[model samples]
Target: MPINLLYSPECLEYREAGHPDSPERVATIADFLGQKKAGRFLLPGKCKEEDLFLVHSEEMVERVRENSLPYDPSTPNIRGIYDYALLSCGAAEEACRLAVGGETSFSLLRPPGHHAGSKRAGGFCYFNSMAVAVKKIPGEKRIAILDIDGHHGNGTEEIFREKEGIIYVSVHQFPAFPGTGSVSFANCYNFPVYPGSSSSTYMKKFMNALSVIAGFSPDLLGISAGFDTHRTDPLLDLPLKDSDYYLMGREISSLNLDTFIVLEGGYNVKTVGNACYCFIKGIGKEKHGQETGKRI
Candidate 1:
C-alpha cells in the first residue's frame, strides 16, 4: 500500500507568470514529491475528447481547442493548454481510479480546476477536472464532492446544483470570491468561515460536514484541496497552520471511501509545500494502516 503521487507533465507547459495560480505550484509539489518518493509515481496522459464533453458543452469544449490563442488575457491558454487541461483531467480520473481500487493516490496537477464549469473557465481553471473525474466513476447514484478551497467552489456548485447524483460541500471564507456557498441547502453543505478563524472553528464545521459525508455514503469522494487558507498566504486571511492540514487529510482518509484529491489553489510557496508534505504524511499513514499520531 505505498502512496502513489499522481501528476501530469503537461502542467509545466501551461504557465502564467506572476499569477497567484501558476505552474510553479506544481513544480513545488513535484520537488516535494521527489523527497517523499513513497511509491510508484503515475503521470497522466491526454484525456479523451468524449470525456471532456461529458461535463462541458460542445461549444465550451471546442473554444479551448480552436487554437484561438495561447494564454487568454485573464487566463493562461498555451499551445499545449488544450492538452495540459486534458492531462489534468486525466490525472484526476486516475487518482479516482486508484482510490476506488483501494489504492492511496494523490493528484498533483496544475491549472487548478475546481473553478472551471460546463461552459466557462476562470480562477486559472480551464476544465472542471474534479467533476470530470467524478463522472468517470460509473454510477447512477448520488456522489459527494467535498471542496476545501479558500474560495467557494462556484463552478462545482453550478454544475451539480440541480443534479441529483452529486452533493457539493464547500467550506470557505465568508464574503469570499465567487460567493455562492453560504446558504444552507439539502444538496449543498456551504459553510462560510470568516478570516482569522482558528483550527477549533474549522474543525467543528469540518466534523459536521463529515456527518453529511457519512449520510451520503458517497460511492466516491473528491477533495478540491486548496491550502491558501493558511494565514501566511498572500491572498487569504485565514490562519491555518501546517499541522492542521494533516489532521484534515487524516480525518478524510478515515471515511474509507474512494477519495480523489485534485490539487487546487494555494498561493504561498512555503505553506503549499509544507501542507502538501503534511497531507502526504496523512495519506501515507493511511496506506500503511497506521495511526496518524495526533492532531499535531
Candidate 2:
C-alpha cells in the first residue's frame, strides 16, 4: 500500500515564531518528504464545528474563539488560531478516514494535540485532534489509543476515561509537564518512564502495554505518535534514538489491526523528518485490509 502523508500549507498560517512547536517543524518534515518524493501528499479540509463538540465543551470552543490572546506560556496566541485548530482537527479526521480505507496515512499537523482537554489548552494543543477523530467515528466498535508522546496525553485520557469500549495507553517520561498520568486506572493505562531511560527499557514497557491492548481486541488502533523522546530533543530527557521509531512502527504494524497515526510532539526539527520517514516505512511494509465504517 502506498503511504499517504496528509497535510496542508494552510497549517503554517497559524504560526508563532521561535516557539518550539513552530511552523518550521512541519515545514522541515514536509520539505524532506517532498525532496524525497516519499508519500502521496494529500490536502485536508477544515473540521466541522459539530465534530468539535464531540470532545470539547461549548465553553472551551468559545474560549479558544474569543480568547485569542495567549493565556498559557507554551500555547501561543496566533491570529485565526481557532480556525487553524479546526484545520488540524480536520487533518486528523482525514488521516483516520484514509487509514480506515486501507491506506497507510500520517497527519503531520501542528498545534499538536494530546495535551488539549475538554475546557483547557496547553502543551501547544487546543482541540484534542486524536480524541475528536475517535469520537467522529460511529460508536460500538472497540478502539485503542496508543500515545507515545514524551509527555502523557492527559487530555485524551480525560475525554475517554468514563467511556467504555475505548482503551487509552500512554508511554511517556514521568515527572514531566501536565503531570497527571502517573498510574494506571480503568480504561486508561499509563507507563511513566524515568529520565535517561534507554530505548530497550522503553520498548519493554511498550510491549507490556501491547499485551494488555491485545487482550481487549480493539477493532481499530490510533497512535498518538510523538518523537520528542528522541535523545537529542530539547524538550525531554529520554535516550530514544532515531531508529527506535522504526522499531515502534514495525511493532505496531505487526498487530495487523487497522491503524492511523496522528502527530503529537517532537521538537528536534533536524531529526523529526527522519523519524517520521522511518516510522512510515516501518508501518507501510504490508497492506492492511480496509476497515469497515463500523470501526475507526
Candidate 3:
C-alpha cells in the first residue's frame, strides 16, 4: 500500500523573498518524493469557506479573503493568499478523509499552518489547516494530534483547547516564536525542549508526548509534521538528525491507528526533502490496502 500524498503545484505560486517559508519547502519534498517514487500522488482542490468556519471565525475568514488585516512580516497578506491557504486546507481535508477510511496519507503543501489561530494568522501561517482538517472528522471519534514541529502549534492548541474528544500534544522548543505551549492544560499537552537540546533529549520528550497520546486511546491520529528540528535548520537550536525522523515515524506507526499527516514547517531545502521521504518510508512499512478515499 503506497502512502497517499496530497499535493498541488499551485502551492508553489506564493512566496515571500528571504522568508524561511519559501516555495522550496514543499517543492523539495515533492521533487524528492517523485524521484523516490515514495507514494501515490493526488491533486487537491480549494476548501470551501464553510470549511474554514469549522475552526476559524467568520471575521478571520473574511480578513484573509479580503486582506483586511494590518501588515505583519511573519504573516504577510499577499495577493491570492486566501486561495493558496484554501488549497492547503483542502489537502489537509482530503488527507483526513483518507485517514478515517484507514489509509495512510500525507499532505505535502505549503504555507505551513500550525500557527494560525481561530482569529489570527502568524508565523508564516494563514489558516489553521490541521485544526480545520481534524474538525472535519465525523461523529465522536476520539482524535489525537501530535505536533512534531520545532515550534509549538499554538494555534492548533488554542483551537482545540479543552475541546471534548480531541487531544493536542506538541513537542517543541520553548522560548521560541509565538512563545506558547510551555505547559499542558485541559486537553492540550505540551513538552518543551530547550535550545541546543540533544537528539536524545528531544526524543525523550517526543516519546513522552506519544505516551500521552496513546493513553488517550484515540481512534484517529493526525501529525503536524515539521522538519525544522534538524540541526541544519536555520531557525531554532534543536539537534535532530535525519535518522531520528525515521525512528519517530516508526514509533508513530506502532500506534497503528488511522493516521494522516500535514506539512507544517521545514525551511532547510537541502535536507527537508530527505527528512520527509524517510518519515514517509518509515510509515509506509506497513501496507494496509489500496486507498479508496475520494479527493475532496
Count clashing residue pairs per candidate.
1, 0, 0
Q: What is the overall TM-score of model 1 with all chains considered together?
A: 0.91
lDDT by residue for model 1 (150-225), tens: 8888888888886786898888888777666778775888888887888789878878888888888988788888
User: lDDT tens digits, residues 1-296, model 2?
Assistant: 56788889888776676788878888888898887777889998889998999889898888888866347778766678888889889989988887777666888887788999887888889899999999888657789999999999999998999688999999999989988889999899999999888889998998988877788898888899988988889999988876787788777877877788899888898998888788776676544332332221
Ranked by lDDT, the better of candidates 1 and 2 is 2
Note each model's CA RMSD in angstroms: 3.0, 3.6, 3.8
Best by lDDT: 3
Candidate 3 clashing pairs? none
Q: What would the per-residue lDDT of candidate 3 be over residues 137-213, giving only the tens digit for each residue?
A: 77889999999999999999999998899999999999899899889999999999999889999999999999998
* lDDT score, candidate 3, position 252: 88
Sliding window of 10 residues with minimal summed lDDT for model 2: 287-296
Question: What residue pairs are clashing in model 1?
Answer: 71-77
For all predicted structures, in order, the TM-scores are 0.91, 0.94, 0.96
What C-alpha root-mean-square deviation, in Å, does candidate 2 show against the real structure? 3.6
Model 2 pairs in collision: none
Report the C-alpha displacement of residue 235, candidate 1, in angstroms: 1.5
